[model samples]
Target: MFARSLGWIVLLGLTLQSVQARDYRYSDAHLHYVDFFQESEGMDALLKAMDQARIDQSMISGVAVAKKWHEDEPKRPRYYAGDDADAYWYSATDIYVAAALEKLEPRQRQRFHPFLTGFNPVDKNAVAHIERMLELYPGLWQGIGEVFTRHDDLTALTSGDTPRANNEAMTRIYHLAAEQDLPVLIHSNITSKRERNPLYLAEIEEPLRNHPHTRFIWAHAGSSMEIHRHQTRLDFLLPTLSRLLESYPNLYIDLSWSVLQPYLLDEQGKPRAQWLALVKRFPERFMLGSDVVGRFDSLSEQLHGFDPFLDALPADVAQKVARDNFLAVLPKQR
Candidate 1:
């Protein structure tokens, strides 16, 4: 009797493990090839992490600005927000990405979709820089951003006039992106931390309306870790996103880690019904991302966190959000 009961317990454990395992693949739609310090674990480490995480492909870009290590600080700040030191636009970031890719075999290189992000968005000359990068490295760059516009504290820490999504410079960039058939991933927060309304909606909406041809991937669905840290949730976020999706077909949403807690999953880590419905309504428009900076230790965890929500979604929609949606949005040629 004891042996029979033990066998049943062992069988149940295996069944549960199989049921919990992730069956679908993933394409990380958003990832930074470097950190704020303009450093990375290199392509080998990245590829290893991607393999471990089951990330078949990734949209990789460099951080636009490099955080400064101010003289007074005794120890180096671990992250950009650790100190008041200002970060400057580092054009070499794109070069780092290119170098990493150049080292990889052709088949391995195909796994990464490199995005150019080493220019100051507030500078009108930025578009020229982007054009030059494309010209310098033909058939290399697949997309144009993770453009830091109106980002939380990063905007203040960045050295320059705050970048707006609809600014003259970004407008020119958008035109270039459209002409080149490259998608633009922009991190423009929908509203300030204190404001419950979408105060910065126009900044992104203007470009979405004016540049209908340009494909814009709204990073973190206009939410950020900083915003969530300050406010429990953006109460207006859902309706605002729903309205935007209805209005603009060119728009896509990146479901990065920042959006996971306050929006995608609830207190018990169960999928929220409203968000599940929203994703189902526009299955093709949403994509998953690890959004990991230089280090990739958390890459698997960050992505697997979505499984609960994904499990709740319809099978087709779940597959799309997990991987297909991101691949679908990439440039047809590249």
Candidate 2:
């Protein structure tokens, strides 16, 4: 009788362990295929990282601007913000992304969704460039942007009139995105570091209101690492995001690594109640991303950082934010 009891106890222990183990799968919605120099670690490395991270799918795009190594600077800058050298719009970035995808097998290629981000957002001809790319790729391109506009320091460093989401050029692009059913991911900051309010809210709001048919994933919910470093936290961010989510049904949020602190998770790494409630309210409108550019060794770490926040959410809501939401927002027919 004691031997029989031991066997049942061991079986129950194994069942409990299975129940306790969390299966964490993710869809990285805001990944960059290359770095500031317009270079990548290649598709092989990216795929290996994805498999280890359990990233079933990813939205890949090239950086809009390429960092220049000016003659004045003796040493090359390691990153875009490393030196005062200006970055330029490199249309060839899209070509690099396409070539990388072509090298992959059909099944491997299907795992990645590529976005075109090589055009200057402020130029009228930018729309034509996008149209030409769509023709050249013929169904290879899945979306547009990570379009740099009104970004903190990058605005001053980029070699062009600063782009605005509501400008005429972007307006035309929005119409094209709507017609093509492509989602556009934009990095238009909500406000400058010095401002306590939503100083630059209109830049994004105008597009959201004007282009209702176009799906827009507001990168890091309009926050960046530079903004966070200066302010520690945007006191107005939660309320501002809540209002926008309610007002614009088409606006989606990208919860990348930058927005993790002082917003999603608190200083101590615990999930904040307000953000949790906000995400739960619009679970289908929020998704997680690594936002890792070029090198991806930290891909798993960047994504798994959301575990605490995900654990706080209801299982179904967490699932949507973790993997389902991004896939849902992709071009429906694609």
Candidate 3:
């Protein structure tokens, strides 16, 4: 009876701590306005989720590429975009983002920041396409990407071009992003899920070295859900991240949902000491992302995932990761 009472006390203490951590509002560094299949989940649903969750701001974008259906597959996979064949460039996806922004009331519109996606990273004309979008919208886009590169099976299936983060076309786009003062949110997987080795490290590293003036947000810190499923423990992640963070001031990390599991937290759901230390060392360099595509129902859980870690942080640093760091990286409204 006494042991049972002690367990209840500990549980209640943890519950209260969670509540305290969640009391703070958020600015989601990564969010998607569209799904992999080119469906609009609508701005209304997003706004309602934000209101309910007390999310002050969100950096939004459409999927950069559409997942291609594999002809040989007897049945298509439902959740992940890369489960089948080539992921194709979906230029129209950006239009959905624009339309959603148009539907918002002027005041509520300011609460959301839109990013430009859809251009093929390997296309020489990609820079021109982005320039045209900038001209047409005239201050509508706050940033560029969730740009996909070196992804999972998607890389094998991707047609027309094999996208590399440091390719000539992407280099030009980075220059344009710097010129426009926009942070680039890039999704370049560090390693293939099956390999669990740093095969694609140089792809992201070269860009970081080349673009000192441009701010680059590394989505999921170069992780993916599929990658985590293959190898739950990211033993090398900390050392690699530390080296990069130490080298590049222009680089930032997006700790999206994929990284929350064994990378940041242990199997027991406690914040891993190493990850917690990294965040403390670079409080202004890290941010949280839901990486949610076309759905707002999971928004609360996505945002809440960081609560324990946030609770462990110094108050100022916690606030920065939760909201200020993301806000700081955004292009100021003109």
lDDT of each: 0.93, 0.93, 0.87
Identify the leading candidate in terms of lDDT.
Answer: 1
TM-score, cand. 3 vs. native = 0.90
> What are the RMSDs of all candidates, in order?
4.1, 3.2, 4.7
lDDT of 2 by residue, 276-305 (tens): 999999989999989888999999999889
Between 1 and 2, whose TM-score is larger? 2
Which candidate gets the maximum TM-score versus the true structure? 2
As for lDDT, the candidate ahead, 1 or 3, is: 1
Residue by residue across 145-220, what tens digits does model 3's lDDT show?
A: 9888887767766677788999999999999999999999998988887765777899999999999989999999
Mark the 10 consecutive residues where model 3 has the least summed lDDT.
77-86
